[model samples]
Target: MPLPLAPLIPLAVRLGLVATTTFALTRLVRSATHPGRTDQRAEDALDDLGEGLSLHRPADRAEDRQTNATARVRRVVRFRGKTWELDAGLMARVRLNERKE
Candidate 1:
């Protein structure tokens, strides 16, 4: 007697559809929650340019140094009005060194 296989085809298709749907939804939620880095980089660049062009007294060297140091030490991402530190330590050091010219 041949084994019956017709009954499992629909069940397998439904299971595959559910899995694909769940994976897509998870990716959509993840992307919605995390803003892209390009936007953040453009904002930072604009802020720096504005600071450089301002008529007011420039920020003191000490303050600038402190800001640069802290920025290198703690990379953060802003999402949903919340700040999250994303990288530090060795990777931060590597990024800091890349600026040397």
Candidate 2:
């Protein structure tokens, strides 16, 4: 007797195959670029953000206090080019005068 195809294959196996193909394509494109052509823009952006903010990993009884303090400090600001706030999400952008519109 032949086995059922859909029931025999697990969902994880299908997802893994898709992921493997994507990784292969990404590597191919990355390798196609010359070594010196590699851009440090992304790295530089990350370093700049790290300089502006610090992450606190709490492990003690004071974690809750620290978290609350940070949360309360959040505020909205309006300025020359645009209006926005420096919060968890904007922290990633870390740009000045940037607005959604």
Candidate 3:
């Protein structure tokens, strides 16, 4: 008897289509270049975003980093239940943080 080939054939075709499409799109994006190229627009847009976007000013960046470092060194994790304060998580994190520092 012949092997069951009907379902396998369509699956193979779909896999081939997907592979070819992925290859084409990968080439499209990876081969990006300057003006007059296929992916010039995409490349230029990404370049513009990288050049234009800034989350913080240079003067404040140091201060922000210092604050974050200090907090990371000092913070304690805790879950508050019916009690006024939960000390189990807090004391453990504090001990660990203190040891690390």
lDDT of each: 0.54, 0.54, 0.47
RMSD of 3: 20.8
How close is every model to the real structure, measured as TM-score?
0.32, 0.27, 0.32
Native-referenced Cα lDDT, model 1: 0.54
Taking all chains together, the TM-score of candidate 1 against the true structure is 0.32
lDDT of 2 by residue, 1-101 (tens): 97778875788798999999999999999999876764588455433443233445345535243331111134578999899885431222121233567
Better of 2 and 3 by TM-score: 3
For residues 2-82, what per-residue lDDT tens digits would candidate 1 score against the true structure?
999999999999999999999999999998896655667645554444211122323553333322321324357899999
Q: Model 2, residue 79: displacement in angstroms?
A: 14
